[model samples]
Target: MSLKTALRVIAWLLLAGLIFVTLSPIDLRPVSPAPVQLERAAALALIGFVFALAYPRHIWLVALVVLGSTVLLELLQLLSPSRHGRLIDVAVKLTGGGIGIAAGWLLWRWRPQR
Candidate 1:
């Protein structure tokens, strides 16, 4: 597979993992709830870099995917049996995604064009 194809696969896997973490039941007893959740949101945002790199020609799609997935995951959280969804978490996810997009754009700008 080409490098771009590999990156795309990695991006999809990360997205799937994000979905699983958001929707499935997991033990949350060991970590501080707020920080752990925040970290996940931030990491999700950073993961956007993979999409941005894998699809530089589709930056808007990358942004849409990041933001849309974040919203979707937040909505899914409402169905969690042991957890409640919060607006702040949604905001944090958005913030992280937006920052990640900006970071990706900057990186793309600096990368030597093919």
Candidate 2:
């Protein structure tokens, strides 16, 4: 019901989506007009942004979790014969997460304090 709770729920949902899309078969993946790299980056960025909003005081931890999750998920792809993990993809995802964190921090900072 509170803003913090809402943000946390959103972040969790986004993470769930990332896990699903990353681990699911290619045929089960969501369709998007954007390129695969862009989609991956944007998804992680959104998750990072929501996480930043949810825990503004733990930005470092947020970055760690986001980046770590990205790497771990990509690596997990190796378990699926249809999926291949790539370093370049992880690079894009990390960059996007950093950008999202910065943006979210800025927005949170500018919000009117209670």
TM-score per candidate, chains pooled: 0.84, 0.94
Cα misplacement distance, residue 49 of candidate 1 (Å): 1.1
Q: Which stretches of candidate 2 lie over 4 Å from their true place?
A: none
Count of backbone clashes, every candidate in sequence? 0, 0
Q: Model 1 over residues 1-114: C-alpha lDDT tens digits?
A: 998899889889988877776777757433555686578667767778788888878899999998898888888778888766788888888888878777877788798878
User: Model 2 TM-score?
Assistant: 0.94
Model 1 spans > 4 angstroms off: 28-34
lDDT score for residue 4 of model 1: 85
In candidate 2, where is summed lDDT lowest over 10 consecutive residues? 39-48
**Best-fitting candidate, scored by lDDT:** 2
Q: Give the range of the ten consecutive residues with the poorest summed lDDT in model 1.
A: 25-34
| Candidate 2 lDDT, 1-114, residue by residue in tens | 999999999998889988998999978998988998898788878888999999899999988888889999989999999898999998999999888888887899899989
